[model samples]
Target: MSGPVDAELARVVRDHAGRLAASLVHLVGDFSAAEDLVQEAIEAAVRTWPVEGIPERPDAWLYTVARRRGLDVLRREKRHREKLTGVSWPTEPEPDDRLRLIFTCCHPALPRAAQVALTLRVVCGLTTAQIAKALVVRESAVARRITRAKQKISDAAIPYRIPGPDELPARLDEVLTVIYLLFNEGYLSSGGDRAQSRDLTDDAEFLAALLHRLMPTEPEVAGLLSLIRLHRARAAARFDENDEIVQLQRQDRSLWDHAAIAEAGRSIARAASYRRPGPYQLQAAIAACHAEAPSWEDTDWTQIAVLYDMLVHLAASPVTALHRAIALRYVQGPAEALAAVDELESSLAEYHLWHATRAELLRELGRRDDAQQADARALALTANPAERSLLRERLNWT
Candidate 1:
């Protein structure tokens, strides 16, 4: 408790660091330069906090210092002439560069992997080592990638503005995918010891909410919000006290968050009103069905299967097919599910969920030994200890 003060102080510093970078980069149009401003601002805070105490708005305070440091950096380089009195920079914060600062970090022009890392680093304020760990890469590799990416972006003169209407479609999909991909990592981690990467989930939700504010009327944005809310409503029941994975039927319905469920309902209605019928909207509908059902027996498996079928057609990813197969197992029975699973085995060989689902279906069909073996294979494949433990528990059912 004695040192909690320092922790709180650190939080204040970290919270404003990304915004500091965003503003600095917008003013200077340089990545490493903006980061330097943030570092200097942090260093200043560390030195000043014990002397001046925390300010009323630490963020505003950080912005002031970071801006000054940025100006100082410019002055040192003799570049202040760009802002001669007749052509002085505006006193108001540059919202356009701030927007582009985030968009560029997750820009579709960059590789998806690069987008994820940079978003976490520049926008989420994560350190390169933390980002490397999050992405399961070595710290040195992450450091090099970050350096190269920033240099390339600055060299290529990636514009610092939101996409225009003509350029929105392709860029938007990549942005949405990266956001959801981060959320997925948090919801049900594809790797690591934790059952869910709460940090990643929080970051994804933060970005999605930011996007919703930026594009309020956009149906796809509403779809993503709805989908995340509906899924998050079930978070309380995703695992049990023993940390075992709680299958939907076995989960406690009373634990679901009614407020979040209602929010998701409003979002779903908002998206459906658009009549766009995109992937996120369809997925939200599936979530809505599960949320609306009163009990396991009352759940609309048929409707969910249909949604998955639609998703398979639209996205055509192995992940979607895997979900559709699981839904079929519920609606059409284990034999049908097995046939669907068989189709995904080759492409999804490393996908632990696919193996786990197949094991369950096989067990339900009285193929005990095969079920046990499949479960074992899935347990071996997952780095998530929580998921692995859940698979082991399922194996015991054999």
Candidate 2:
């Protein structure tokens, strides 16, 4: 409740809630019960942290408290205590356990919407109200969806263990989907002035690293890790000294993390060694083409266009088509790219990036008036402060 304690509480929720919930799930083998225990531990923090001062290891402290609470609940339930007794006390779960936890939370057995909502709540540490706001649904609707997801997990008796090697491929895709969405939400950011959330991006990178360690032979895992590292290597340059969006061509190369870029290169090589390429591998290859290039004009757009062509075949989405069009600009010229953009107009009409890309292509064609209108539409559709600022600056260009 006090200022310092409140900030600490927020930090703990954002940073450690998922790990704590993962530990509890392993111990209690119940989704709803573990979640409740974590909430109780947080509430206890609110009351006690202010009085006792924050502990040295806040996450460890929360985990200990929540585990104790979960045990108490199991004992008090009388009937469930038999089930709980069979469940051995979980030792400290490794970082990879959180991946398993999220995979289970987003299990394909659940409805797709519930999978996303539950993953955001239990694994991403988003409050129901926050999830509701992000999802543009009523708070109560989000609450019920999460509740239903928990019920499904409980009823279906979804085990809280990572998939075996045989099942890893299928389950890994679900885990990657959750992490990809989490990272993108932080990378471009959904609706904030800050271009990225360090917490979400860092968490995503951590998950990717854990996945890589657990399944080093999996090409897709290596690809996803490389993709994340490549983007993170440019995190510093994405925003300017004023925290505004910096166009890729204008970003200071000196500010980019060359070390991270090198690591990404290594990851890409690891992925290639597997020789079973996936969408993430193709996407990372495109990112590598940019990372290796010295300047925008010097970038190997042809190679990137080829990779995007591969990516489009692997995962044919409007977003991928839009990105492929961007790469087409250098390989086939702006007219070709503009035609590609126009083809997606109906599908991505409300998508801000579609209009933004259209504006760029139109600008190249000397249609300044049409470009300005496209830029305005982009600025109108997006709520992200960084994006809006970039569009406004583009619109003001002569």
Quote each prediction's TM-score.
0.86, 0.83
Q: Lowest lDDT 10-mer window, candidate 2? A: 190-199
- Regions more than 4 Å wrong, model 1: 1-19, 39-54, 71-75, 80-96, 190-198
In model 1, how many backbone clashes occur?
Answer: 0
lDDT of 2 by residue, 51-160 (tens): 89888888877776776676687777865555545544335678777777777876878877787677766765666665665555798988888788888888888777
Candidate 2 wrong stretches, greater than 4 Å? 1-23, 42-54, 57-60, 79-90, 93-99, 111-113, 120-142, 159-168, 190-198
TM-score of 2: 0.83
Candidate with top TM-score is: 1
Residue pairs clashing in model 1 are none
